[model samples]
Target: MPTSQPTPWGRARGAALGLVLVTVTAGALLGGCQQGQQRQQQGETRRQEQALQAAATAQRRDLDALVERCQAGQAELVTAAAALSAAEAALAGLEQRRYSPLPRPPAPDPAVLQRYSISDQELELERHQQALQAWEQEERGRRSRWREEQRQERQRLQARLQRQRQALSAANPAVLSPAPEAKLNREALAAFRSCKRETLASLGS
Candidate 1:
């Protein structure tokens, strides 16, 4: 029987060895594929982390800028509050003194004098003083036709008064009472007073 086929045990051992080799080779191939897939996953995870970190950095910068603006706004509010308080205090102080000024006195009449005596010589002196003032005011710096009109008016009054004095001197005391002379003198005095007022007012009294 062909040497009993070299004992079937030997064939069995060879088959077993072949099976073990195939199994080990398959295990090594699977392990290598798993390792490659793991490396790919790790690379993708790293890329995702980097993208997240970049986005977080941008958001942090934006938050920092917003915080800075809020701080600046708070400082401005403090300044405005101080200014408003100062203005309110000033208004309050002014309100306290709003009604404390003294009342004004009445206007004085032009004919009244601050002196003690009344005489014709003194009155004539006052009239001459007024005429001198009018002349000085007209000559200082500049003049107009209005000043000439005032001068002419004063001259006419003076002439009329001179004529009245001559008439009084020539009149007889029995024929004419002094009443008419007194009336004429009063009228002339009133006209002279009005002329002084007009002159002073025209010169920005």
Candidate 2:
């Protein structure tokens, strides 16, 4: 018995069908890979945006902390100025007593510093002639030390502020809002401005 051979048309049709299947399969695979690549790119972009947001939030938190710390210290500056004013008034009154003129003023009244929480009680003596000389020497030593301590503290604060300024170029504009210290008395506000100017000046040095 003779087996029948396939016709040319039949073979051609079979090969065409195979080619169509191969083309469809290749297109599906390429499409799947493209979708996966797009998803990866989108995920990476989202992660970067999230990281930037977190960093900005952290920076704002740090800046707010600094603002609150400085605001809390405003009362201390006002109290110090008040205490100095009181001391000056008392000295003026003492100098007017020409009949028994005291050569030196006694230690400033420590009462003025009571509310300011100044704990030093060394100058808590009664203003009298007997201990006037001794009081002067003690006051001198205390004043000198206090000035040096305050200066160092100011320098430390200024240095931190300088670094903050440099680090916060992209900080929010709200950081420029006036602090609570702005409500202080004119003299005290001026003092704060002077202090800030000193801090800024240190940046150049």
Candidate 3:
């Protein structure tokens, strides 16, 4: 018996089906690759965005810290300046009083002293002694008061300077050296001391 051969149409149908399966498989693989690439891109973009947000947060924190320091420094400066002015005023008053002390009693005329009787002379001597004692007492009290005031003013100035130093220390330690405001505060402290010394010398003179 002769075997029947496959029809041409049947072979063509088989070829077409095979081609359709190959194309579908290729499309599926290409879609998977594209999806993977998109996922990778998305991940990379997320990382970049996170990095930017972190940097911005850090920058804002630094700026806030700087502003706070500046404000604190300004407040300290104003307080110190007011203290300095008060110290200066006190020194001025002390100096004025020191330079112009109580007036001395005038010397009695020699003729008048001789003309007076012995009893009268004794009474005059007693009165002169009393006046001298009173003057001395007044001078001592004034000097004591002046010394006390000077001591108090010096303490105030020193305390203010100490506060300024503390403030400077509290500021950004990341900065290697003193800032301009700190330098200015130091200069002010020096000037205050110099003024105190000069005023004391003037008082002494």
Candidate 4:
């Protein structure tokens, strides 16, 4: 019987070793898995052992397809998890200072400073400093009243992010899983990595 598939292994043969159907015959492939073959070949055999070999050979192709599907699903989950992590990091880095870091009040202008004597300059500096400090303190109080305003936006983003995380986890809790295990050919591995890269790139990262 001829090889069969949704994706022809012939096309991927060059890209993936030992993953091609056309390049490797069934007998050659089965030879590698022959531990109990000696016993099976004895005692009233009707080529059934070879039939089982062909069955296994066909099953392996099916397995290869499944491997690709598993990897693709995993790759999408990985990409989404990376995005959520980035969002969390950005949220943590949000500027949320309760006390407004008002800049140091500007110094007396150059022309004005040039006209003042040393004593006068000292007196002016002291007055200006006191005045700026008092103004800044009051300004901070005023600003503090509205500090939580931006906080509301941050909270909204956080809540939305949390909801998204929960929904995604509900869909596939494997996102938080330990080290993953999935069989992959060379092309499939490359495809999986490329999926992640394209996802990040689409997000403008």
lDDT of 2 by residue, 1-205 (tens): 9999989999999999999999999999999999999999999999999999998798667655645554655565545545444544544554453332335755565466464443443334433444787766877787777667666755665555443433221122122234422122343344343445343233213
Least accurate 10 contiguous residues by lDDT in model 3: 168-177
Considering every candidate listed, which one attains the maximal lDDT?
3
Model 3, range 8-29, lDDT digits (tens) per residue? 9999999999999999999999
TM-score of each: 0.33, 0.37, 0.37, 0.37
In order, the Cα lDDT scores of the candidates are 0.52, 0.55, 0.63, 0.60
Instruction: List ranges where model 4 is wrong by over 4 Å.
Output: 1-79, 95-100, 106-130, 142-146, 177-205
lDDT of 4 at 205: 21
Q: Encode model 1's per-residue lDDT on 11-94: one tens digit a residue.
A: 999899999999999999999999999999999999999999998798667555544543444444334334434544544554
Q: Give me the displacement of residue 129 in model 2, in angstroms.
A: 55
Q: Which structure is stronger by lDDT: 2 or 4?
A: 4
Considering lDDT, which of the candidate structures 2 and 3 is the better prediction for this target? 3
Question: How much does candidate 4 score in TM-score?
Answer: 0.37
Output the lDDT of residue 179, model 1. Answer: 50
